[model samples]
Target: MAHTSPAAAPGAFVAASDVAALAAGAAVFGTGGGGAVHTSQVVAEQALQEHGPVPLVTVDDLGPDDLVMLMSGIGAPTVGIEMLSSRHQIDLLVREAQIAAGRPITTLMAAEIGGSNGVGPVGWAARLGLKLLDADGMGRAFPSAAMVSMNVAELPCDFAILSDVVGNVSVIKTIDLHWLERHARALTVASGSICLGAHYPMTAETARGAVVEGTVSAAIRVGHALLSAADPVQAVAAELNGAILLTGKITDLDRRTEDGFARGSVTIAGTGADRGRLQRLELQNENLVVLEDGEVLVSVPDNVTIIDAETGQAISTEMLRYGQRVAVLAWACDPIWRTPRGLELAGPAAFGYDLDYVPFKEINR
Candidate 1:
C-alpha cells in the first residue's frame, strides 16, 4: 500500500503509514549511498501492518540495562538494489548478534540513518517486538564501517554478525573497527555484494552521547515536507537547513563496483539561470565531494545529495542515469563529525583525498 502525505502519527512510533515518508527523508540523508529505500519502505510497511507500529524511543527513553544493537546492510549500493536480504536472514543475523553479545537486544538502532539502512531496521524492530532507537551512529551515511560514531568513540565491538539472503551467517570477533570493516567487506563481496550486519551492541547509557540523536523523527518530518510541499527542493532545503548547490542535468557518469563499493563520478551541466557551469560529484557508495572548476563546493563529512530537480525526491548513487535532471543539495553534518577524531575517521583525507576538512559554514560563507 502506497501512502502519500498522511498526517503525522502522534508520539514516538513508526506506523505503516510513516514508512514512505521515512524512506523519502532517509534517502535525503543518504547523500546518495545507503542503498535506495524504496523496497525497504515496502517491507517495513508490511511488517508494521502485521506486527503493529514499532515503538520509536530515544536514549533517554531507554533504561540503562536495555541492550541496543546497530543493524544495517553492508555492501555496494549498486549491488544492494539487486540482491536483497530476506526477513528470515535478518532474524537469524539479529539473533546471532544478540547471542554473541550475551544479552537479548531490547532495542534496534540504525547504524546509519540514511537510505535503506534507515528504513530496513523498522521492519526488524516491529517483527521482533523490539523498540527502535531514534538515534543512529552516523547522522548520515558513510562508505566504511570505521566511519561510525561507535568507532570514533573507541567503543569495542566484541563481535560482528553478518548474513546473506541465502542463510549463510558469519560471526567475526574483533575489537578493531578497521579490521571489522576489512573482513566484513570481504564477506559482503563474497555474498554477492549485499548482506545484513549487526554490531556495536551497547546499553542506552553508553549510546546516549555516542550516537546522533533525534534523526529518526527528523527524517520523518523531512519526508512529510517533501511529500506535501509544492516545491520539494525548497521544502527539503529548509527542512534540513541545507542549500541547493546546483541544478542541472547529469551529462556523464562513470560507475563500477570495486573493493565492495560503488565507486564513480558524475558530471552535471548546469541549467536555468546558472547556465554554462559544470559540477562534478565524486562517489563511493555516497556522494563524497562536489567540485566546480577544481574548487571544492562540498566534501565529507558534509552531506552531498542529489535529488530529482522537479520532484524533490532523492536519487540514490546506484540510480544515477545520464540526462536525468537533478539538484545537488548539501548540509553540514553533525558537530561531532567535525571533531579531530571524527575527521580522522570520515574526513576527505580518510577517503584518500589530500585535503584538510572544511566546515560547511566556511564553504557556504
Candidate 2:
C-alpha cells in the first residue's frame, strides 16, 4: 500500500494508521539495522494509545533558544529481541536528561531514522508532551552513536542520560564526544547489552547548523517507495540513487558476542549477473562494509544493507546465516561525511580499517 501522510500535523492527531505507516517506512530506512520494525511499531502503538499522539514540530518552528533533547536505544539488536524495555526506562532517561540539562526539554528529536531509534523518540515525546522534530541526525541507520554526522561536525555531546530496563539510570557529562560514546557503550554493556539514552540537547539554532535536514521525510519516502514498487530493492535504489553492490547466497558466517557488541562477517557466493564472484560483509551491530573479490565495494558512513533476494525484507546483521540468498545495497551517505574532517571522525579508518575512505559512487563506478 502506498503511504499517506496523516491529516493532522505530526503530533496533533496521529491515527494508528500513521504509526503503522511510519513504522513500515522506518524499516525500509533501517538499512539492515535498528532492530525489528514489528517490535518498534507495537511499542509505538501502545505508547500513542496510552499517552496520546506525539506533537510534531519543525526545526524552524522551535525557538532559537528552546532546548531540544535527542533520544534512542543503543545495544545489540539481538539482545533487543529478548530484553524489552519498560516505560520506566524511557521516563528515567528523560528525567535524568532534564536534570542534567538544568532546563525543561522543549522538544525531542530522533538520533536516527530507523525501526527502534525512530519510534523511540516519539514514545518519549508523547509521554513528555514535548514536540518531536520532523528530522533526525542520520538519514539512515548506523551502528554507533558516534557515527552520526552531528558528531562529525563537532556538535556537543556533553550532557546525556542513560537508563536500563532494570531501573538503573545515570546522567553522564563527558569532556569529549568520543568519551561520551565510550562511556555510554560501557554502561549499555553492563546493563545487559542494551539501554535507552537521551543526549545532545542543542538549541534550535545549533540544530539547524549541525543536524541533517529532511531525513524524516527521506525515510518516509524510502518506505513508501519500497512498499509501492513492483521491485522493492529497485525502488530503494532508485529513490536513494544507490548501487546494487552484490547478489549472492550466504556461504559462510562468523559471529560472536563480545564486549556487548554483536560483531561478525559473512561470505557470499555470487549468482546471476555476479556469478562466481565472492562478496564479504563485515558488521558490528550494523552492516559496515561490502567487499567484492577482496576489494572494498562499500564502507562505513555510507549505508550497507542486506535484504532477502526474493522478499526484499531487510536481514539484520545478527540474523545472517549460511545458505540464505541475499542482495547487498549501498546508499550514499550525507555529504558532510565525505569531508576530510568527517572521514577522520567516522570513516573506515576510525572503524579500524586501514583503507582510506571511499564513496560508494567512486567504488561502484
Q: How much RMSD separates candidate 1 from the native structure?
A: 4.2
Reference-based TM-score of each model: 0.96, 0.91
- Give the per-residue lDDT digits (tens) of candidate 1, residues 83-189: 77876997899888878988789999999999999999999999999999888889999988888987777778878899999999999986599899999999998
Q: By lDDT, who's the top model here?
A: 1
True lDDT of residue 317, candidate 1: 95
> Model 2 clash tally?
3
* lDDT (0 to 1) per candidate: 0.89, 0.76
Global Cα lDDT for candidate 1: 0.89
Off by over 4 Å in 2: 1-15, 50-52
| lDDT per residue (tens digit) for residues 1-365 in model 2 | 10122222433444344676576566656766787777777877877888776666666677856898888888888888899998677777777887888889888888878667876777667777777777777766777777776776777776878889989987788888778888888999999999988889889777775776666556656667777779987887788788777788999999887877778888888899989899888887777788776788788778877878876667776677889998887788877777777678778888789886778888777
